[model samples]
Structure formats: C-alpha cells, structure tokens
Target: MANNIFEKSITDSLINRVNQLTPTTPNQWGKMNVAQMLAHCNVTYEMTYENKHPKPNAFVKFMLKLFAKSTVVGSKPYKKNGQTAPQFIVKDAKDFGVEKERLVQYLKKTQELGEKHFHNRESHSFGRLTKEEWSAMFHKHLEHHLRQFGV
Candidate 1:
C-alpha cells in the first residue's frame, strides 16, 4: 500500500486502523465482526508460523494454484465478499481485545524478524517464498480485510 510496504510505520498504521474499529461498526462488506476479521487476519501469519493446520492435498494444492494463488500473491486487492479458508469463518462474535492483541503481537514478531528472515522461510503449504512475495501476501491480505470492516 505504501512505498515502504514492510516498514514499521505502515504496519503500525494498519494496527491503528484496526484499533479504530468498534464492536458496533457495521461492515462495508463481508459477514465477519471486527474481532472475527482480526482473527481471520491472524490466520495468515498462523499458517506461516504455527504448524497446527494440515497442508492441503495434491488436488487441493492444484486448485489453490489455479484459483487461489493469484488472489493471494498478486497485486490486485481481494474482493469484499470473496471466498475464505474454512477455519477462518467464525460464525459467532469474538472477544475483541484478545483478537486485537494477538494480531498486534503477530505483526510485531513478523516485523522484528524482517524480510531476510522470511526470504527462504518454509511456508506450511506454499513451500518457500521470496521476501517481496511475503511482503505482498502480508500487506495485501490485511488491507483487504481492514477495508472490508471499514477500518
């Protein structure tokens, strides 16, 4: 979004935008509450860090390659009501404070590690990523969800 995509200033600004949202704020698009949206955002980093979720099978991987990869790593922004990972679909509301703090911690951890640390990082599903691709995936996904919740 900004010239310095991975700079603390940009990440901090996104955090601020997330903090600006309240529980009562209506979504400009999408079904998730603000807290759920934050949790949804955290899933990307969780996928990168934690090994809790299983990797997709060959067929599923092929499908993601053909359909999901472009939307995830490409320059175009995600549409407001587009498809989401099954684990990310929180039907009920979430505790706002918990989700917010967790996401902030994830962001801080990621930034502290920086690009080179992630340049050859093994992704749970995608194998490995270049620093720039990691930056694109992180920034674009967060921007998409933040815009959805009107933050």
Candidate 2:
C-alpha cells in the first residue's frame, strides 16, 4: 500500500524529503532542474486548490477518467521521463525558494484538511475521487519526483 498523504506522519516524511533538496540538486534523470521540477510538482496542488488551470472540457475529462485516472491514482509508480501534461511543463525559470515553499505549504494544507475533506471530492481533472485515490494521487507524484532528485 502507498502512504496516505492526509496523515501527518506521511506528510511530514514527504516534507522531510522536500527539505532534503537544495537549489542545485541534480536529477537522476529527466530535463527539469531542481526549481523547475518543484514548480512542475506544484501544478498538481494548484489544480486542486486554485483555479490557475482551466478545467478540461467534458470530452477531455471523460477521456482522462477512462485512460489516465488509474495510472495517476493507482498504486503503481510512474515511469521516469514520461510525457508531461502541457500545463505541467515548466519551461521558464522559477525561483527555487518560492516554489519549494509553495509545495511545502500545499502539502501541509492537504494534511491539515484530512482525508474526510478529500473523500469523494471533485478533482480538477478526474472528477470525484475517494480519499484513497486522492492520497495515492498526491503521494505517488511527490514520491516519484523526490526520487528523481535523489532525495
């Protein structure tokens, strides 16, 4: 089973992994620099908590549910150097400090909100998800990226 992001212990563990990264941390693979990777990771939380990205049209949402939802929220880990969503591609430079702080804050907020807050919540992309699906989506992505930086 995957770690539950809504639990403080798991959240703290993830935070500690984030804290292990520095501005110049080298990636084990992939193109993103440390800061860009952090910013890319922030996109997930931004979709959830903020209206930064436009919601997909009904057809797109349906396709996402059919094809991407399981891969995203399933216990299986993501392969490295996989195709990234357009919105998640961080091409421009980003401030390392700002992006890192934003990610940490988002993780803390998610944990504080607890599992009940996320149960059957309408995800920005995947429509309604159970608490477990939400936790897997949050935890698996962070875990994959943190591992990418060798944290």
Candidate 3:
C-alpha cells in the first residue's frame, strides 16, 4: 500500500519535511525558486479547497484523465524540471514563509479529513479517484517538490 495522508504518522513526516525548508534554500532543479515551488505545490490543494482557478472544460478534463492521470496518481515520482500544468505555474515571486505555512495547513486539513472522506472524490481534472489514488497524488507531489529543493 502507498503512504497515505490518512495516517497521522505519514502526515507528520510530510509536515516535518516542509518544516525543514528555509527561505534561502536553492532549487536542485527547475526554474522555480523555493518560495515559488511552495506556491506551485499549493495549487493542487487550492484546486480542491478554493474556487480560484476555473475548472477545465470537458474536453480538456477528458484529455487530462486519459493522459495525465497516471503520471499524477501513480507511484512514479515526477522528473526534475518536469513540465507543470498551466494553473500551477507560479510566475511572480512568493513569500517563502507564507507559502510554506499554507501548504502545511492544507496537509493537516487533508490528513484530518481522512482517506474515507476523499475516497471517490471528483478531482478538478482527473475525475473521481480512489483513496489510494488521492494519497498518491498528494504525497507524490509534495515529496517530489520537497526533494527538488533538497528539503
């Protein structure tokens, strides 16, 4: 089984990884600075919790479902300097502390909600996903970015 957000210990370990990040930390790969990377990571949670970004049109969603779903929800770690979805691109600078705090809060919230709450939840682009898929999506993303900045 995958490392799941429903498990408090897993969530705690994720939180610890985020806490290890500092403002001046340099990226080992990618164009985004640490702060921008944090903000980019938060985009996923924002898509779930906030209505800031418009949902993809049906065709685009279908395309995402067909092509991007496995890359996201599967166990494979993202490649260094991998292409980001348009919505996730953080162009401007970000406050490291602010983004970090927001991500940690989001992680806590997801963990508190538990896996059952997210089971078969409809994703903005990928449609409904099992709890395992959700966990893989969330955990793999954070772990990828955290490792990118050497956190």
Write one digit per residue (lDDT tens) for candidate 2, span 15-100: 99999999999999999999999999999999999998999999999999999999999988999999878999998999999999
Which residue pairs does candidate 1 place in steric collision?
none
Model 3 is weakest, by summed lDDT over 10 consecutive residues, at 1-10
Q: Choose 1 or 2, whichever is better by lDDT.
A: 2
lDDT of 3 by residue, 92-130 (tens): 989999999999999999999998899999988899999
Provide the overall lDDT of each model, using Cα atoms, as 2-decimal numbers. Answer: 0.78, 0.95, 0.92
List ranges where model 3 is wrong by over 4 Å.
none
RMSD of 3: 0.7
**Which of 2 and 3 is the better model by lDDT?**
2
**TM per model?**
0.89, 0.98, 0.98
Give the Å shift of residue 113 in candidate 3: 0.2
Runs with alpha carbons beyond 4 Å of true place in candidate 2: none
**Against the hidden true structure, what lDDT does model 1 obtain?**
0.78
Give the per-residue lDDT digits (tens) of candidate 1, residues 56-97. 887887787678776777788877688887866778778888
TM-score of structure candidate 2 = 0.98
